[model samples]
Target: MLNTQHYPQMISPSLMGEWIVIASEQEFVQRQQIKTCLDGQTLTLHRDTINGVHVYQVNFESLDMKELNLSVQAAYGFVWLCIGSEKKPLFQLQEYDVEGARRVPCGAYGVRTSPLRGIENFLDMAHFPYVHTGILGAEPETTVKPYKVEWREDVDEIWATECFFTQPLAAPSSPQPQETEYVYRVASPLNAILYKVNTAAEGIIPADVVCLFIQPLSETHIRAHLLMILDDQTSSMTDMVLFQQKIFTQDKPILENHVPLKLPLEKLEIPTKADALATAYRKWLITKNWCYGVHKNTQEEQVV
Candidate 1:
């Protein structure tokens, strides 16, 4: 009587109510339909010549693709969908508006890990030396200097500032190994932004921004999309995209190997001082009662 198979699993309301990224705008070319999933829900995307992009979910009785009839919009080079009945506003990025900023979109990798884990990894500074070695950091400069993290109640987001790290190559425009300053912003449960001070021309130029947007295909699986708003006048777009792809390839294996798959929020191991932003992210999720792509240390938990 019902097409229960349409939605393979029950998605958390918190996640459903949010505008989740389905794919980069570039993926939807002409009238081609892009089939994808979000939080275990199957989706089909269509774009026509006259009308814009349209999203659909399987119908109940007929078991055919039907209009999702939810909030669908495009911004920052990505197509966003909110399946919940009442839609929440999508997050913003002012840096995207800067004039002459080179926009680079890099990734749609099917990562075998929780979206939460990916975000936490992006927020970590201590792993730079070992994980992203030579590019983001290297040995002898492995210190994660003191930083401040704050939970902005008004914005319902987390911000980490005053963070510093030594790097072999901070950005594509970096002349050589140098010190770098970072500001991380958790824009939503599934999106984050990294702001690196424009070392090429500090006060005069705006900080380059790298954004991470995750599409939760399941509790333990996700697709990560990246967009960069950069002010580098020297590096070519291909060079910047390749540089980011290299960093991502380095991180992919590490992220996939995380035990338990989903982040264990309740039984988390003791964190080091360098994990301030990571710890804060978990706490923020807990405050919001987030349950998607997270483990609560229960006995019945599935480790797969």
Candidate 2:
């Protein structure tokens, strides 16, 4: 179990069933002991291999030096830590189980922004043309088409589909520009998955998945853990990782500077049809009664 007193906003029951990224497998292997501060408390993570299976042991300072018997492991080169009970189902979906998809691990990048803000920015496609420029989007193709957004009753997840965008370099192996179709899923408040059409090759691939898992250290700090499950038969893993890093590098400044750090659940001043997914996400957070990382103008309206 996680120390909820140290991470009340992140350890809420609403997010108990979700998995959080603590460190990369490489980071743990290289450092041996990884130290992180969460909610003003220090957590030291140590790596161990049991019967040739990699695992991690975590020690919390606030818990009176008690060692958590958690066995952290790497899935697709990411070090994952769970906060919930063993009986609860994980937030993973079948889409993430791509057999031949190359895993490109984008190391945990720190940002002085709310975790919700990082996710909301990832869900925003309109910024590609301006922020990502020629890589993801470009000028004259800036219009965002209307997409469908709804809560899936069967899975209890929010989805947005029918999203199409023209991109110059949608993937590292692409030779020319293509029209990319996308489907976005908010698996949880701190997790999001994107399924995109890979059209750079003959017989375009139906879907290439990218998962974003965010760790909220505080109300105003977060670390983005990105994993890309791609279908590219070309391009080396190093090339793919560099390409993805450049895109996020461009997004970092914009994300870090977002006003009012915490997300606002109220109506926006200039809400557009393109913001449908973000709107739905905000509604979902409100429904879950998750307000620790949210902001309200009046003290009486705050949830903390």
Candidate 3:
């Protein structure tokens, strides 16, 4: 066997069963480091200075890479599938063929076909601008404002139109159900966002972030898990459920039609203004050395 000892990294397969290695290191015994590639672009990761010690951080807004998390990967895949036009048959664990292929246990959301290929990067974000256009994309300005948000090395500035307005824009409804409801949106192992959407475009603010998890299912599939802490008790089950369904349902049909094809991400044409986020996203993906879309620029790894 080739001496794998020198390369101590996490290994897994993509949904298509392609082998992958997350080459990374740890600063201290307790601190761990992981890497990921997006759209076939490798990212140069570095330590972020928090209070004092080093911590993992990435600015998706700026295309910076730091650490790897499975939960975030799943979130990316989930949204990617919901928006892309390529078609592929994906099944949940409950609906898989046991004899045809071995079932691999995945993360909280579980695994499905990889949705990274054949996707138009900005179109998905643009969908949010026009489709869910009610609350978030209320205006053309909001769609582009967040792009101008500044960033710091330690704190990644996120200007989510979803969380932009804190106070409710609508009046509260009648008494809600008994159970407390919450929605969690996480992007990495350390960061998370939580809240509920009730009334027209009104609800409580996302107060506390809980945890983030990312895991791989197969050669092309990955899972991203997120946890959130509720700030207060409430009776908003109906409102929250409706919100989740509305958002997810709108995305489901769009995602299910994605074509099953992988691009030589490294061979893509030069990016343009619309691809600002994708440009950054590609850089981050390169660090992992595996991504879905075509890329014109490829960094030559120096083998000295």
Candidate 4:
């Protein structure tokens, strides 16, 4: 049986419940069988597309098999599977005002790192110039300007705005270097969305949305699922996927090698002005009492 006390922050009750990305819509359609190991249990998810309707069945090793009547819907080109109470509200992608926004399915990457590490990396803008190099950021323009972080009590979400960065290739459809404006939202502990200026597209829309949802298989194992809703009219889906993949490929090694796999809620090794958002994120996790992937300090009181 799964222990709720030891469950990762990604599956904490304060954030609702566990929602995992089993496969992408294309992968489900092509393979028909999706296999995942959750909490040391292997789950075989089978799909049957009949009359254009997708049906799913899950089989657990040495356990009762069941067919799920839930309809499979593609949200921004990815298929998500939730394993929790039916009463919990599901995570929804933010609606953009841009018409004809193209959805791209960036591939899922398996990483040997904590889910929190994946998100912490995404939230950090200071490392872009060093980690992503000229693609996402360049040298001599490494200043991370002050940004505002607010906790929306009404929605119980964290929002960060007024972020700006210079990028050589901000978008796959654009070749010119430009200053990219960014806004980030932490919808849940394991889910985050970034909105950035789409310089390559012609539209009244203010920005495009890129979402990263982390699935925590264990304290040190995770799969990063990426999706983008962009206003770009020039780039093919394949090109867009490759571009995002390249950026993530550059980050994978750094994330995997990060010491202290679990996140530290206090006493950070390095501190900077850009870490305001990350600081707020750690406090939010503490408030929720979610500590499965957090480093424990023997001197501090146990979080239960």
Best by lDDT: 1
Residue-level lDDT of model 4, residues 116-227, one tens digit each, is 8889888999998999888889999898989999998776778999999888889887769999999999877788999898777777456888888886666677889888
- The whole-model C-alpha lDDT of candidate 4 against the native structure comes to 0.74
Q: Give the per-residue lDDT digits (tens) of candidate 1, residues 189-223.
A: 89999999867844433688899999888878889
Better of 3 and 4 by TM-score: 4
| Better candidate number, 1 or 2, judged by TM-score | 1
Candidate 3: RMSD to truth: 16.2
Segments of candidate 3 deviating more than 4 angstroms: 1-10, 13-124, 131-143, 146-214, 222-235, 260-264, 267-275, 288-304
On the 0 to 100 scale, the lDDT of residue 66 in model 4 is: 38
Between candidates 2 and 4, name the one with more favorable TM-score.
Answer: 2
How high a TM-score does candidate 3 get?
Answer: 0.39
The residue pairs in collision within model 1 are none
C-alpha lDDT of residue 116 in model 4? 82
* lDDT-better candidate, 2 vs 4: 2
| Residue-by-residue lDDT tens digits, candidate 3, 41-118 | 333334445687444432232332223222211121121111111112221212122222111121133223233421
For all candidates, the clash counts are: 0, 0, 45, 0
Residue 168 local lDDT, model 4? 83
Better of 2 and 3 by lDDT: 2
C-alpha TM-scores of all predictions: 0.89, 0.86, 0.39, 0.85
Estimate the TM-score for candidate 2: 0.86
